[model samples]
Target chain A: MSTAIALHAPIEAASRAARSAPAADAARADAMEATLRALVDAVPTATLLFDADQQVRYANPAARVLARLCAPDKADRPLAVVGDWHPELLNSGALHLCSMHGSWSGEVILGVGRGQHKILLLHLSRVGADLFGMTVRDITQDSMRESELHARNAELEVAYAKLQGAQEQVMQSEKLASIGQLAAGVAHEINNPIGYVNSNLSTLQRYISQLFSAIQSYEAALAGGAGATEAESIRRKLDLDFLVGDVPQLLSESREGIDRVCKIVRDLKDFARKERSEDWIKADIHRGLDSTLNIIWNELKYKAQIVKTFGELPPVECLPSELNQVFMNVLMNAGQAIRDQGIITVTTSVAGERVRVDIGDDGEGIPPDVLPRVFDPFFTTKPVGSGTGLGLAISYGIVSKHHGTIEVSSTPGQGTLLRIELPIAQPR
Target chain B: MYRILLVDDEPNILSALRRCLASIDVGELDGEALKVEAFTSPEQALERSEEQDFDLVVSDYRMPGMDGVEFLSAMMELQPAVPRMICSGYADRDAIIAAVNEVQLARFIGKPWVDEELAAAVVALLRPGSARARAPKALRAQAASARITRVEQDDDGAIVLRSDDPA
Candidate 1:
């Protein structure tokens, strides 16, 4: 992400630019040689005088310093400097072209270090027969400044991308929080009415029982036929016997319906209670799995046959509500993965100190390429609007929070198995 | 003959509790006087209980003005030995624990209770020398600071304790 360019490139249009450039006289080449040498030495630019053999004849202070940088031992010597490191300096063809042409100016890059370079401006002119005056200017500093600016721009791009990801996570949590609050409110509202209705139904049931006992007592009292005709007529007209037989069964059925509603409301409340707190508790994984399964039973009832194989496990330390959410998310995903009929088998076991839970599904298995990316946020095979794609992501976070590891292995067209191994006690 | 007081914000709920008293086996109540009084207001129930001695008090956890915890605690101040039970749909964990420790709530009946379950709880509380009559304060204090054990289900099935609620 770096950019480098020579701003004052004096060589590309040297035919016009050379008019302002400092140059040695071509007319009085022999007469002003001494004066020209002194004038060139006074210039800050590195000026080198080369003989016909490409040897260094005379170098000004700047040229001497640059020579030491590229050629250390030959700094004091007037012999020709090695061309390997500064081949561009010597290979620019300025000297060769100056012999055939009037004036030659060109730009060449010279290696300053192993991988770094300096843009040098080479100006060549014939001072006398087989002798040439050359000026070199280093322009690497400006080029490095441009490169550093570009590198910083690239770093900012990486940082912005990370910020976007973090922001998305925050928004997701907020969304869940609002939804949880709404659910809790609804659960509470439902709870009050259900409470009264449940109580009333129980009272009705008791009243029915008492009425039957009263009828039994009346029958015993009238067994002597003291008021038999009148009582029999009243009973037949009111259909008392049928009423006594049907009411209890009807009440029992209504009781069942109330139970179902209570269970649903309980689940709704649990779902609404956000597990935002960080308090860790000793939790039983098996019980959480069943409640979660019952809560989300409708989602899987039609999709797959669930098989549960549980082993003895110590109560693992965790947030029960959060774990319930994790289980529901994974279970729902498993149910949705199946297109038609499939089997989702969940098994738990104790492996020494770690409790392991494996949820395996025989459905349209994840493709090899997509299997590894399942836990990535916003990654989903479900259609748009059907899934937010954060199920596995949240699950991953919850499991990680518990100091647990979740791994998934899948065979395309066969099945996928996700194993979550958690420590019984999370390390502080 | 023993008289029990039932307090709830809902008149219908109070009436239901009155009917539930009939279903409770009288033999289990030591052939005592079967009188069930119902009240819709906690203040009135408390005020009346002060004038007349009640053998037991069954109240809903959430009520208007005063919740079951506050109402029951105030009642305990007036009559300390009366057995009390709270029936609630939901309450904060802290408040429920407080109710248990502060008022010595005899038992907690979850919402949507069946007739038989309510009757059974009443019978258990009324029986002579029953643990339900007097809550153990020391045990409640110990339980208040006890380690939290959270249980969940596994793959096979859940080990479920029989719930007093209809479910």
Candidate 2:
């Protein structure tokens, strides 16, 4: 009877222990599920899980808020309840446009919801057979800033272009006005000789007629064997030797005067010719320098000595006259810069598809601050009446028009170099 | 006796030229023997040249109504054999090209000219059969053709002709 009671006790105790072990396993599983729910609720991003049929099997606390804002009944309901809210995501499996949830289409915006705002970057990916995971983030401030930055950049570009155009116009007008003023001086200088030559020629013609008549009379008197008294009177009154010698000299002087006047007139005409655009030819830049030197020779020759180092440059296609103006401006400036005997060096060479010309002056160098503003229109360091300050500015414009570049470099008390680079080929 | 046509827009220059010419004589050539018809206006010179003829046409390149090239071209049309001489203090590449191409000039004298060079240029131009009077018609035609072709090519290409900036 003791053995029987012991065997029953052991069996009953073993059965109780086995039952408690299953209950502990079930309790551990329930705690793990609760921990998972807490993690999803604490997550900042909206996350949702769908079953094979796209029904909302699970939605985190944040996802619930998103669903309520997008489609209030979609939390525990079928995903089809919110299908109209994101029809694209349903059809294409995933959609990335920000405005998918808002009135503004195709724009990135934060989707606002109950007690939370999500960037709501909608992304859908298939997890298994028909199950999917949707994720949303928040990026509200970044998108707005990017758009504003782009607009600001565009405005800056427009402002820069306007500034460049205004600078160019002012430079061009200054050049034209200077040329007009110089033209008047050139005209006046040429007219002085022309006036005198016209008057001298008329006087000379009258002298010749009188001399011829006198010669004829004297010859007739000598041929007719006039009386001694008549011959004596003719010799005394006429002073035949003086009349014959001095009259030819006077006539010759008159002829020379007329020649001088002709030359002055011709030069004036050449200087003032109307500008023409019919001829666009390939010209040697050296020729332009030479011509400019000739035009401004008077201004330079007395104060400066020019040194030329010409390279074997190819011909450049351009309007020769306009280029001549550029050279004239630079050369004149070089001459004016010198206070005493100084060297003006003009060097040319072929650089790539362009020709580079360096007009350097060994005069007082431009100050560092002034160097940067040399090409600014109407900015002159010279006295008021001496410079219009358009020389360098106009040169800059002309170079730009030719699809060229002008650069300046200077060292105080040393000198300045004006570099002009012009393409050999014409601007297409 | 050589007849010289002196054209200048300035009356002062005309008077000075008259005085200077009166002072010098080459050999037995009397200053009075040289007939000079001075025109302060280019139009007047052109009209006068058409009515008669001149041994030489001395003209200024830049004038109010017409330039030296145009004036010379007109003069050459009326009298092809007459020699044209251009003198200018403002001798630039354009003036040289115009003198060479448009005027088919006899000589280019830059100012302020020396007395000897001035006399020699006048004498040479006046010399019988000394001047080469042919103009390059082919070059002018080629220039025109090239311009047309350039315009056509620009049209065919996608080059935007931006409007001139009003700034």
Candidate 3:
């Protein structure tokens, strides 16, 4: 350890002057010492003073607090243990380094609070002959705040990713909704013409059948005998019975053919009516289901037999038409799933405050991977224009509007069950 | 022979219903079974209906001259024994509810109804003692159960069996 610390010239000159005039100005020198001590104590920096012997002399209040970190048992902060710029190197390395370089400064970590380490900047410099000064600036709080900011930034990035996913779903739904509105308008406009044309066709059929009937009757009368002159002339010429019977038979068949076209139009009209909106009313779910069945019967009647097991339930408050749409979508899907012959079972029951409807089918069931995404917009197993891929998606939306839930479960080849749980009465 | 009066604004509809009833009246049986006084104009139908006796009246609900409810109500006043049938489409729900009160032997025939449905309605109107005749609309519909015939393979690759299918 160095016996003397390199001191600054001005401090040495002042010390020399104090030594020489001490006898005549001892009181003034004493007052100067008190002022310097008070200034060091007032500063927040932890500062320490060492005497010519390189031993600790004076320690301000800040220095005393820092000393407790290294020397927990000591009342006096009498030393800065510096060996290779390490606090654990409790030796006079700063004292020796200051003598050669006139100053030394570096960052170090010290034991501060019960097993806690604190970052600190330490500076050592010569102040007078054989004297040294040390200062420490604690930097623990600054670095901690910096790390917390980094963690917060990472959290924000995750939240933004989730928000983007939700936005995409909303956009898809909006696009499909606009298309539905257009379809409804087209359907409403076509209703009237279909009505009259349909009636005309049925009548036309009746006419054909009647004409056929008259011809048959005239043939029968002729087969009996061509004896009466008046009757024979009328049968050979005007053929009154033939005109009446043949016309009716032919028209009846023609009307039947026209009626087929009318049905297609009517089914299309019902599909468009999904867009028609009315206030919520207490309505029979069975009625909605039945009407939906009638509308889509052509699709199902060939592929599947229907079984209805409806429970006794009070009329549910709902938009009857909208619910009809939901039923149609589910039922049609069930029918399409069947490759050949199958059975579709529709069961409705009241559970607690909810009305539960289950439509199950013994058909080619949904794949496990596909089932989860069945209600996702634009997700479909059908090829190209065979479907719009919005059936289940729209069904989901309608159920959601009614504050209800729809879920499906299926096995690969066994069957599928779609369950709809709706509130009995929606809040007005 | 049963006498039926059929009226509609549309010429095609009047001709169609008249022919259908004419076939049913005259066909299948040995001779003409019923007489239909068919007219395109409601005013003309009203004139003819007053000049003759009709067992039943089936009229289109929507007409430029007069709605079916008003037409049926007028028929109710003139021929109290005759059943009044309205062929209505999506429209006229409110009017039907109102007309149901004034009309005797009131019957509603949904437009684009199948041959079987029209036949049943005709039989019910003529034979008042039949089970479906006195039953209310809802009950009658229930009693008219869906008839599923034997399924047959169609050329289109669908196994379909249509029995009196209007659609």
Q: Output the number of the DockQ-best candidate.
A: 1
Q: lDDT by residue for model 1 over A62-149, one digit each (tens)?
A: 7756666665545554434425226556764666789888568876776656576667667887776666767777766766787898
Classified by CAPRI criteria, candidate 3 counts as incorrect
Q: Compared with the true structure, what per-residue lDDT tens digits does model 1 show for residues B1-167?
A: 87899987656566556656765555666666678888888999989988999878998876646779889989999998888888765534555566666676666665666555566656655663432332245533322222111111222223222231111
After superposition, the stretches of candidate 1 with alpha carbons farther than 4 Å from their true spots are A1-65, A77-85, A88-428, B10-22, B25-35, B112-115, B128-167
Candidate with best TM-score: 1
By how many angstroms RMSD does model 3 differ from the true structure? Answer: 20.8
Put down candidate 3 lDDT per residue, A138-243, tens digits, no spaces. 7777667867887887888888888766644553444344334334222322333455455546655554564566567667767976556745565555445655
Count of backbone collisions in candidate 3? 35
The local lDDT score (0 to 100) that residue A303 gets in candidate 3 is 59
Ranked candidates, highest lDDT first: 1, 3, 2
What would the DockQ be for model 2? 0.08
TM-score of chain B of each: 0.74, 0.68, 0.69
